[model samples]
Target: MGTTAYERVLSVAVAALHERDPEQLWPLLAADLPALCGGDALIYKLDNWNESEGTLGLSPGVTAEFTALGDEDMGLLRAGYPLAAHYASGPDRAPVTARRVAGRSWSQSRTAQLLDDLLDVDHVLGIPLPRSTTPVTGCMVYRSGRDFTDDELRLAEQLQPLLTAVEQQRQLLRRLDTPSQEAADVALTPRETTVLLLLGDALTALSIGRRLGISERTVHKHIANIYRKLGTHDRVSTVLHAQRLGLVPTASAARP
Candidate 1:
């Protein structure tokens, strides 16, 4: 793509971030991919960790069929695959991309096989989607019949930061819309709410107990009650939910 095209992509990405909506980001990403590398593109986001679920597409028609491809097609982007794996393992890390694959095996996956039969694509370039301190939340794939040029690779690299910014903005929007457990007006003792707020601030149980002049076991009991009340299974979800309810400040917003 030309410098003008790259500049347009960056402009679109920034605008999408400001909108804080996934739907707005899709067309910009879709348009930029074909310009950067003459190929159809798909964006996928890691959604379910245990099931290894990732969402594909940009908007309503988007699906996770690409990552669900049979093992063969996955090997072409080994670096991308592992990078996603690592991201799923920890959602607080930045995304990584597999710019190039070792061989033509990328053409062998179910998606590739279908594309080959229908459209004749043979090469793949995978770029990870941007994320905050979480595992790779998503990726963008570029598929074409011919090898990518050096210029195309350079352009993709330049676009990485833009993609990351888009991802971070999406995540922030999600957090903002996420409802807090405390917001349900679920009745809790004053001490329980205090404990929940402290947890949201990332205080350890021990530290919470010390601060509240309670025993650690007592703090743990309060946490257990908080989890049950919030229908949360872990600390992270509880804290995120708490923040959504305006019961706590996000880490970035909290007093130092």
Candidate 2:
């Protein structure tokens, strides 16, 4: 069967996102949206567990309000809007409102208020990707003075699966940086393994000692043993080696 326009656009978006370098991804986002929706595109990393402390922009001339949205903004949205929850629950599409309270006024939704305060965005169509659990990593297509049309919304929806796959690949690449557990365990003793596991949970020597019913000095000794076994000089390296060997599951890998 022939591919639809939506399929073609979505394929291109996914390809752009999955590019090895950020240089390639940004251009596709910037150029495609202007042609598709007649408005600029803004991409955010949505890091720090609450959409804070990440880069934001199209190409650098767009002039976004929050280069990185913060915890407070996320909290407000969660408390006042249904968008976050709906996305987490696997909604294919979400609506952006301008007010905190829905059905009260167009001026009540937090999304709308942000648009009014931040940029020239009037209405937004939020097409959430599959991998995004809390509305953190998805595209927010904006119109200066117009609402999204049915065709545009349909196009965005079609892109969701590809967008999700791109995110998964990005996450997988990050995991590659962690140390392997097999490498860590090469010369580690049983006691060192236990210590490494505890350390991976962010436990200090004293805390590990308490948990293992040993003295703090003994915990330190175990950590030293762990480091020697793994051929690492520090706690971070020790834990990284443990992760690579499957000694500890990363948060990303632990997700269902």
Best candidate, TM-score: 1
Q: What is the C-alpha lDDT profile of model 1 across 230-250, one tens digit per residue?
A: 789999998897766675567
Give TM-scores for every candidate, taking all chains together and pairing residue i with residue i: 0.49, 0.48
- Model 2: residues >4 Å from true position, as ranges? 1-18, 22-31, 34-38, 43-60, 63-82, 88-104, 134-136, 176-256
Clashing pairs counted in every model: 12, 15
lDDT, candidate 2, 44-138, per-residue tens: 34442233344443534554455465767644433323444445555444434322213445556666677556666656555455445553455
TM-score of 1: 0.49
Q: Score each candidate by Cα lDDT.
A: 0.56, 0.54
lDDT of 1: 0.56
